[model samples]
Target: MVDGAIAGAVGSAALNVVSYLDVAVRARPTSSTPEETVGRLAGLAHVDLGPEDRAANRRSGLGAVLGYAVGIGAGAVLGALAGTRRMPLAVGTALLGGATMATTDASLAVLRISDPRTWRRSDWMADLVPHLAYGMAAAATLNRLRPPSARCG
Candidate 1:
């Protein structure tokens, strides 16, 4: 249990680091109309998007935390069910997470929030690597450190 908990914490921290890096990367100026690009980046990074119906895709910080809690809970449950076979369970969780992420991002688009498709190279580079690292590290830790409760089945 301690190991599982540790892994979860490490994974969450890693993901948050990725999140910050993604924010920083998107803040850089580009070759496009600098003003418009900056404005869009600013809007994407720190807009009150939840208030406007057209851009109500923004989830509160607490809401995002709750979402992560849900994800962790789901992962823990799945890991327990799958027992020591942590790889498969983690992969399942990652797949599930990816689906959830895509759906959330799509909702953001529907609400006129940030469009990842238009993300600059830095944005993609910063975001992708960290998330991948997060997934892999999380999976490795959870799978490798199977909790006692998970050892039964």
Candidate 2:
């Protein structure tokens, strides 16, 4: 569990670094999908986020936090599984990336936050690269933390 938490934090950090770098390089606006999703969920749950003026800001902040939470949660799950079933590096990386993408896409689609089907090639690439980095970092970290005898091929 401790190893999983550490791996998750490291993985989430990697994701954030990639995202920030992309923003710096492209000067593109950050996606509001997270915020929108938060708002939608809040609406559904009838959770009032204070007054309208403060609600938007709170939602935006919470949205970013939620992204990190998801990353960490995913990493923890991956780490836990890796402990019991050894996976090759390549396979582990792919699994982490795919899992992360699937979780995000499913949440967004179900909440009507964004439809990946409508995303441009550039948009897809933008999302993919960082996630790949995240997967690599996470998988590598988790593998390194395992005992030599337990490490996968």
Tell me, by TM-score, which candidate is best: 2
The alpha-carbon lDDT assigned to residue 77 of candidate 1 equals: 51
For model 2, residues 1-153, the per-residue Cα lDDT tens digits are 557667667777888799889999999888888889889989999999999889999899999899888888888888776674456768767888778878998999888888889999998988888888778887777777877677554
lDDT of 2 at 56: 95
User: For each candidate, what is the lDDT?
Assistant: 0.52, 0.82
- Pairs in steric clash, model 2: none
The clash count of every prediction, one per candidate, is 0, 0
lDDT of 1 by residue, 1-153 (tens): 444445555565666676666558667432222223333444677854444543423333344454456446534554555556545645644653464356445655565556788989866565456555556556666766764344323
Position 15, candidate 2: lDDT: 80
TM-score of each: 0.50, 0.92
**Model 2, position 22: C-alpha lDDT score:** 94
Q: Which segments of model 1 are wrong by more than 4 Å?
A: 1-9, 21-64, 70-74, 77-81, 88-100, 147-153
* Candidate 2 lDDT score at position 135: 80
